[model samples]
Target: MPLSLAYAADFPSFADTVFILPAGTTELPINAAADLPEPVRAYVASQLAADEKLISINQYTHHHYYVVAEAKKTADLTAEALRKAGNKLHALLKTDKIPELFINDLTPDGALALAEGIALSAYQFEGYKTDEKSKKTPDLQLITLVGPQLSTEKVQELDGVLQGVYLARDLVNMPYSHLNATQLANRMQAAGDDAGFQTEILDFVRIEALRMGGLLAVNQGSPEPPTFTIMEYKPEGATNEKPYVLVGKGVVFDTGGLSLKPTPNSMDLMKCDMAGAAVVTGVLTALAKNKVKLHVIGLVPATDNRPGGPALAPSDVITMYSGLTVEVMNTDAEGRLILADALAFAKKYNPELVLDYATLTGSAVRAIGTEGIVYMGTAEEQTMLELKQSGNRTHERLVEFPMWDEYDDHIKSSVADLSNMGKAEAGAISAGKFLERFIEGCPWVHFDIAGPAFLTAPDSYRGKGGTGSAVRLTYDFLKRKATV
Candidate 1:
């Protein structure tokens, strides 16, 4: 990817792309803008005004969305509005090169910093040669601005957070052909050192002693050793109130164990099964880098569900760390089984909050598709409201769901204490219920991102790969709680 510089008095030579105001374009978009290059503007106008019968609107824009008047209304609000609108443009306007937005807001550094985070998140890894030509992405990087008040310290702070987002995306986008348990531990260790956090990668010997049955059971089927990564972020002037505990199900590669999944796309991208880990890892990195005055503990149970000599089977009964015996009714329901153990472990810390995220159920994909995070937490309306607001701001959609006891009857087992999977009807709801059981009464939140973690098509701030979901929403939620 070649890099060059240009000048634009009409915009500015320093501006890679100028924010535009198309002819007769009105309304202040709190999310998007009426901006485009000369060619892009003409292309958008031509498409809106097609051949035989042209659509009639005083003004026109791209065909990507329905040219909503709402996007136009959002642009003139606050820096928060401008920054969010910039997020949409950063993804929607990419051409031969990656789309990058350089704003001239003269805005507060906080808002500009958020924009940098958005652009950094719009990253892709396509170094590996492939047959799919369109799969290749533009190397458009770096959103630079020239402002008298833009301090060096502000850019450094924004760059650190942006780097954390890219680091998480890199880990999520990397194929399992390269990443395993040990490799994942090494990645976290490197991030931990770089971000001023402490990473303790527990090897198989320690994992066995701790009896992480779900993690061990998943790894038993694979030759690769399992890793339990514990990261602690304790900043200065932190409060004694319980810290946030984040648990991720790190099934490095889930082959469905004895109960193999029907043929699907599992060649190179299975490594993203640890996306929860990647997100939590990145959040901790940001917190540590900024020296956020809070306590955050990240728990990742890493392994692979495979079918080998020592693999646990459907009829097998295993003891989870929580001291509950689970009947492995189906090996494909491995994520919850692992997360249950970690969630239970989190209780020992007596934390004020615990949030666990996973690519838990296929049914979730059927529910919300690939653009939202399915969330169900305790009866904490204010907390959920904060999460949802942050989700909207960060582009990590969080939708609330029910976690009632109506489905508990499904898990009752004849052979063991409980069955791994219930009747397939409410699989997503059942998975949430299963996680809630371990949280016991803690204000726990469960995010089943099965639908949104991976994309089959292009989305905002996303390409054709692992969309680094949840990081922005959760991080923003915590930052609001911390600083706001």
Candidate 2:
């Protein structure tokens, strides 16, 4: 069940309460701190003396509980730190099967960050589990914020962002057996309906008419048809005249086609290859739900690369939507092909900026592991710096790579204008350079999300499986843009 948040004028009688206080402080920050029973107060003080960051007291006689969560001092606190603290509190409460709890508000920013972390950590994907015992639904469902600092508007904005993150994670975690190319577009349309965005789905015929050769070539291997989804969110009195375009590579499942990937670790998590598409959808949803006054557009070209049909093989040269030919050196390099067509298509909008996200290279994962995003772009230095700041604020950190002309030489082909695969060294930068061709001088950024898009193990509030890597970072960036 989705967790719900409510506002309370004061701490309710006989309700379990969580007191958020600064580190090393024995006194609760609430006005009713003196009203607690002597034994509970003594126990909390003792736990604080021992330097326990979290203190739980079971007041069985009073039929309630008290959880004291110590946060970093205000001078030392950051958004990421508060979120990590919330994740710790969530784990403790969930383990004990606590059904509901009330939290004393700190500052507005601090409270909202804590709530966001708890809600994100509470996410569960048990849809495929048949047995009831196997499903691990979160026990903590209702989170009531008690205190005046957090306004209803602020809480609503936080709720929208959390919902977006949950939506992104759910899409990435879904097996291809349950979600295919057409279904992915339909799901995006459904999200648009719920969030007040406009969605236009272009079927295979439309794609063919547009001569999207790169997308079609990738779809040749699969029985499923391809879909190009366009989503627009333009609120009244918008801040920008030209929309900011976001393109996502939607390879629903990747078997690497003719250049098949190994089954163990390489192909096992291929279901997450479309995580970039999910991030775009998630960001649009958050923006629309929050009613941010910014014009944004999202494009996703989706298909699965299977070897069952007439798949493109090595040494085949294919044309893209931009009328540029690319030699298919490795079928596993299919993501850039589909993304190329979408990036080319985005040019019609005369966008202010274009950003494309994809799990496009294993070279990126090898370089940075699952800790950070590898990005490179032709956007101005100020834009890149702002994006980096947003990433840092959300803890979805980024590591920039160069897009030097030297890397462009690696993708040159004798038979075509370019090659799908580049030289073995600096593979990630070469992939970015390949994509830069489609922008046609438009300011653009490419995020190689192969590393942080999914995780094999749980990481605090990010959880396991799909990490919803770029949603938070991009949403933070867009939100700031709207205000500016």
Q: How close is candidate 1 to the true structure, as a TM-score?
A: 0.80
Query: Whose TM-score is greatest here?
Result: 2
Q: How well is each residue in 152-251 modelled by candidate 1, as lDDT tens digits?
A: 4555555555566666777777777677878888889888998988889999999889887877887778988989888888887876377889898787
Q: Candidate 2 regions off by >4 Å?
A: 29-32, 61-77
lDDT of 2 by residue, 1-484 (tens): 7987777778766676776665456655445355567776777677777777666665552223333344444422466676777888887787667788787764544566777788888888767878888877778898887767876777778788888888999999999998899999999999999999999999999999999999999999899999999999999999999999999989999999999999897898999999999999999999999999999999999999988768999999999999999999999999999999999999999999999999999999999998899999999999999999888878788899998878889999999999988888999998999999999679999999999899999998888999889998999999998999
lDDT of 2: 0.87
Q: List the residue pairs that clash in candidate 2.
A: none
User: Which is the leading candidate under lDDT?
Assistant: 2
lDDT value for candidate 1?
Answer: 0.69
